[model samples]
Target chain A: MPLRRWSAAAAPLAGSPGTKQIVVARENWRARAQEIAAAGGRLMALWASGPAATGRPAPRTLYAAFVLPPGLLVLTMPDDLAHDEYPGIEEVFPHASRMQRALFDVSGWRSSDPDVRPWLRHAAWPADFHPLIHETAPTAAEEPRPDDYAFVRVEGEGVHEIAVGPVHAGIIEPGHFRFSVVGEKVLKLEERLGYAHKGVERRFTELPILEGHRLAARLCGDSTVTYAWAYCQALEGLAGTPIPARAAWLRALALELERAANHLGDLGALGNDAGFAFGLSQFSLLKEQLLRATHAAFGQRYLLDFVVPGGTRADLAPEGARALSDCAGHLAQQTRVLRGIYDEHAGLRDRFAGAGMVTPALAARLGLTGLVGRASGQAHDLRSDAPWAPYDELAPGKAGATEGDVAARVAVRFDELFESCRLIGRIVRDLPGGTHLAAGLPTPPEGALGIGLIEGWRGPVMIALEAGASGSIRRCHPHDPSWQNWPVLEHAIIGNIVPDFPLINKSFNLAYSGHDL
Target chain B: MWKTLRQIARTGIVTQPPPTGDGSLRLREALQADIREILGRALCIRVVDSGSCNGCELEIQALNNPVYNLEGLGIRFVASPRHADLLLVTGPVARNMDVALRRTWDAMPDPKLVLATGDCAATGGIFGETYATRGRLASVIPVDIVVPGCPPAPERILAGILAAIRASHAHPRSR
Candidate 1:
């Protein structure tokens, strides 16, 4: 079932890091996707780019990127403009359903999928007016019509639908969750996201390719390092520019720091959700310390604009590297001790152990990926699976568990935290000598396609960039792991009690803004 | 239990130079009197993510950390708009969220203040005035103060909240 194994032997797609690309005919698109699905290739992202965004007279094209056992494989098929439709892979990859819907919303192109519910357009703009294709966009000043988007009904005895939000009780991003529950047990869970969509795909065409990293960093704040790095990676690849050795190591350091920081925050939040306030206090303290150290090292708490095209924004100072290394080491020791406290706590263990199980079989079928997938025995980490530069040399340890529960996810987080600390220490200790930014970076020629894929803290964050007329950004797509994982969450919550939804949701912590964008 | 206690004891109290709403409080005695009369010292805020990159939310959530200890100053994030005295919103106003933002503001009990946090909320940041978004939060809702930064620091968020209360106390009808 494994398609030739994901080794670097297969020719890499032009202007991408170890990812293979094949331009398939529209007729064979579905069959090719079926082959990939049968071969256990995970669908990474499915997006469409049209003439309007690309600034070309050519027909609209559909791009499907998959993670085979060996590495990243991207399949592209140009659309038949007469039909405005392309073959849908939803049957093979169930997660592609939402992506196809979003694809139709962004590009004017439709997919062959049966269920054609509007995903991103929630009665805000005219139904006929597609933002990417159409030149003029609505001001959205007038009152929008109430959304008539129907939620699938589950009619049964004592099965009542409980609506949760586009706006929630807490300070998180907006997304509505409709739960059809019988008493406390959830019968079905459906989500209606895309409330945060700001026409970023269309906006990309307007910005210069060089300035796109800033926008990419802002796509999702927590995953800033990955998003920026991925965008720059695409740009760097297109320009045929290899970043300096020191910049590569520094980028990895920032990435690891981000991962460690997020884990600390989530671990604490999980503890708090499980009624352990003390864990929140301690972990939050540690997270703050890490953030402070990060600020000292990288000049930003969250590293919004650190990873620029060609190389990083700034070089690492000796003192800054030392501070970051020291912080990581300190956090590692504290986390090791605290992880033990969590493991031994009977109450905490009970709360986390059996809640919201996504079985390995279910995970594979539904295409659940990233850290959550790792917990469910889908042992895939881009760092180890498709190592690039520092990762190629450093070889990070992959922490996985098959328990497929909140507890398993927590254990993975703990493992990752320790590993990240170790990785950070190594990166700083063996700092390479070179300029942070590349010298005299050349702009990629028009119509050049490049993709940057990275193992972000949340999963494989990708930015597919195609340079436009005169160094302008043509069509750029930023894909978050949330797109694949969010739908799986609905299945994960099934059979679990309603109150435990938050704990399970937080365990994944999928990006809303990035997905919506 | 011993490990938990030991950790807490060792960590001690990290909350230093806790936010003093002093400058704004002393800026206008009338605004102070308005705060005293209409609002209690306890400022209840309801944060709405109109449509943001979630950078601002990170800082807003950090307010709960021990280092900031936002609750220690009697400011707490409430669950409902009905319970809130101020609306601390983040992100640019997405077209889809515009109605929801209006309804949230409408639902809030009057004499409320609006503090737009981060550059996105202030002026729509990077993804500005798009077809899908209405741009800055103020275009949709009247904002008293804007705490700028890509995602402003936790301290700046606190300062914006205080400044919003002070700014709105003078106008009181900005909501």
Candidate 2:
């Protein structure tokens, strides 16, 4: 059978269509960003990784931007990109500040921003160790220094600093946060991540293309389907092989199950954070039910490794489809009951409503994307907009709001949960039947750059794959949505009482490891 | 009052399930068998992160969820090596984490088992042997079993642990 190709231009006007391009001034990044923003493009991401060229001594800095509906535009600096301290886009996109600092530390590329504070390099390794460039084995003598975080100064008589952990009471990943405050109101928040940086990006270069799928899947395990599929998509684009229709359908089913599971658990956890045990119990139960259904279908609760390059590992049985349908019906019914509880609980409503509100202006300036971005009025879902296999045919609905507050985020998640349930049902009902995987992928073309953009549970998971010698990955960058939203959390907590930080923080649920990569 | 009673009748008025079998008995049985296999006879686990993004930790965490109920199997994760029976590590052993991984292995007592969870842990899955990694977990720590998936399903993880325990017991002279 002949292969099919979907145009990136097929994306809806407001969907996530991978890379968006815009030209920024050479060294005057700020000026160029203003020009691009004025032209209606958003500063989606900024990073400086790798050398100017293969085996080159100079660092290569790439400042990327994306516009509404999806197009990725990148401005690669000259060989002197490292020497030229690019003007920071912090003044305009505020969120780019941390990424700028990260680029400086990871690639040794300097950012002209005065806030020269490190973002991810918590001094976990020696100052001389730039893993992205130099090739030296790690030693036992290396020590992870205690993070010395400097919160943004508010300069008030009663202002004090509250530092939270790289370790917390909850069963969550490690990351530190410092809050500067006066009384109970937060003035500023400084985040210290990379405590869980496991050196994922560098490791990709060593694995074979076939094995890279597993590594990508773990980038954000909850969205294993999305990560694996995205990684596979990039590899296939490099190899130029087509994924089987049955495998594509299975991947969709797995992805929808993943999305539904996360949304259910997150919504419940958000309610739990507000002391709504009823909502937590109900949602957790539903999430558990959903996972069980997934296990029945895919042999895993979280659907890990179900997707591989060129297709899925297994086909879904009709029994599995029936189980999914049954699970969806029960979950929807239970959520309806829980929704009333959330609405009736004045105490819960009070904490959630108007809390951690990000105005539309702030969201736009910061380049927020995903549900948190969508909640703040950025309606972009890769499935509906970018229209990848399964989603392309089904055209899933996206839920968004302009409230830009914790309440809005909660509403968006709830709406997404319901929509995901429907998507899952649609997928199972219309599942294609055939071999779930292809015999093998074609040899990856040398020096090809393949980019994959998929809507992960948190948001868009972008993977850029560059093939190297012997079909091995050269530079694989997995950018988690956390890079775009973590800064927004700091801004969201401002003017809000310090006690509600957990509630606010869970609303974003950014991954420390994902960002550290 | 009556409505509440009706709701209870509709959804079942209990947070607890039966001690033995439930509607998900097959899954429960499989999970239990995995737990029994992986954690048989005071198993010691040493977590090695070959090189991963950390998405697998979610499913690893799910192992503790009330539904899957990992603790019910008597299998526990230990922080140090002196008391461990099995090593359950994730990742492909990033260049930076390689030394830490080896040292952690050396600290463990002899007759200990190693189970590599997630694809990275198994074969440098996504984070292939880049400039940073020294290959997969087995390169650093002798792996008894390799759970070959990006992030093995929690049940699969449970299965991996079981397999590791069986491999260790069956071939005490292999290591």
Identify the leading candidate in terms of TM-score: 1
Judging by DockQ against the true structure, name the best candidate: 1
Docking class of 2: incorrect
Error (Å) of candidate 1 at residue A97 is 0.5
TM-score between model 1 and native: 0.95
lDDT of 1 at A5: 44
User: Deviation in angstroms for B63 in model 1?
Assistant: 0.7
Give the range of the ten consecutive residues with the poorest summed lDDT in model 1 chain A: A1-10
Chain A superposition TM-score per model: 0.97, 0.90
Provide interface RMSD per model, one decimal: 1.1, 5.3
Model number with the top lDDT: 1
Instruction: Give lDDT tens digits, candidate 1, residues A397-420.
Output: 999999999999999999999999
